[model samples]
Target: MIPASDQDLEQVQAQFQALVMPHLDRLLGFASRRTRSVAEAEDAVQEACVRAWLGFAGLRDPAKVRPWLYCILRAVLADNCERDGRRQRLVSITRLEDEHEALVGGDDDAVLVEVEGRLTGEVIRAALADIPEDFATAVEMHDIDGFKYQEIADILGIPIGTVMSRISRGRRLLAGAVASNQRAWLRDDGKGERQAEARRAARAGGFDGGVTS
Candidate 1:
């Protein structure tokens, strides 16, 4: 808390407004993508703001304020999950942290272009929702939000290596999801076409009155 002196209180408020207020919209966008509903996102961001204000005085570096705010927001979400008994899925044994660097991510650009070609914004969002939250957050922050590895690490409080792995794996998972969608769409489209063709044939007297095969 700011000192009891009115002058100190005013100074803290001014400092917070200057350093933090500009990012509110961006923060809300981030929270919205991470949450299930807009209402949840709004409540989370609002709570994050309140917590940020309360802890504003302890912040030493103004330059890192954006990631600091994100870290706080993540913590708020985690706490909510814990309170609600949401189980956090952790890394499987097959994906040890050491192997993250070894993932075949050299064609990252090529893969991204392909994925973009196959998916629309709505489809991309759906794909993101289909993956694990941990991987999705890392990928979204890096590809969509344009945060660097170190910045993501700082915000997530995880190692840079782990962040890299999650993104690599996340991209692969997202591509798979997109492909699955395409297949499903093709199947549905084909079924509709077949149904329409059958109707056309019946109308043309191809089925006859008995409709024998």
Candidate 2:
């Protein structure tokens, strides 16, 4: 595409900031759940942002901005996955330790709470990564991002029934993965202790939907 005029560039940037910037965290979360690494997720979101800025003029309906951005993000992810030989890479949970540390920014107890929450998120993300791409995307968009079925279908360019099917299957697989992981942890004394501690911390903070004792 030709470079935008100075005036056009300014207008596009303004619209993008207004419509797309607000969804950056959600986009990053969505990408993170799909990607193997934080760097890859960030790359996908960055590419999507640039594409959105360039194509901002074509997006006339403000109401469709969120899905439009998602479309761009999805495409970027697909391209990256294809180029990487379709390998579903696992994220290193250790990296999350740093994020948890930054998030807690407090004494020991607060640090423990953040670690529990971070591990819960990591477990889910890892499970999602192991599922089929379509199924994982359906589950993440509908369940994690809180999009309606019809909205998911539209974003994915599939029928609503297919979206529902993918989500149901994906959720089943996710639950099995979580349960299996918890059982494995329980089998080992050291890991089991860590798992119990994390759950206790999560409970103290009133967090829900993690490995239950």
Candidate 3:
């Protein structure tokens, strides 16, 4: 790769500061959606940012910068997931797209309500903490951070098959945990009936949502 000129480096840094830094929350939200843990999501994004900074010189096409950053974030998440021996459960990025569409369609009020009713940061952190550390790491790296299997394998110094297995297993475990938590919530609350109904709805929507752990 050609070395980035000083001007190029400065421009990259400026772009990161302007466009990327402002999107930290959105990026974290995206990571959390995939990894289901606030801590892991934060870690994944942090690592991704670090990698992006280090590899800024490789990013020749300014237009591709956003996608490139996302790619790095995903790679970091994948690596963490693999190291954690977490089973990978695939989440559809469709919800995010849907939410964006809702916003664009001028349903701001509905979007705000949905956001308000969403899981809290504390809930995500606690759930992540409940998972095995290694599994959490792997899930954050592979799924949330968006690392490729081979890249994760290289990063974690594990076999590629091991990376795949960890992702698969971690996802399964996470889904089971989410199901169990929902059941527990139903049992503990007076609104057990309503909660149960919600769970049913989640299932109907194919929200077999799993995390890295």
lDDT of 2: 0.66
* Best candidate, TM-score: 1
Worst 10 residues of 1 by lDDT: 204-213
Tens-digit lDDT string for candidate 1 (151-171): 999888899999999999788
Residue 3 lDDT, candidate 3, scale 0-100: 61
Which is the better candidate, 1 or 3, if ranked by lDDT? 1
Order the numbered candidates by TM-score, best leading.
Answer: 1, 2, 3
- Superposed model 3: Cα runs more than 4 Å off: 1-12, 90-213
Cα RMSD (Å) between model 2 and the true structure? 12.2
- Candidate 3 per-residue lDDT over residues 1-213, each given as its tens digit: 656797787776797677578668757865765564468679889988888888877878765555566668768867876776655333333333343344445545654454334324433333333344445546656765566777667656679898887777665444333333443432435353344344333432334454321
lDDT of each: 0.66, 0.66, 0.56
Model 3 gets an lDDT of 0.56
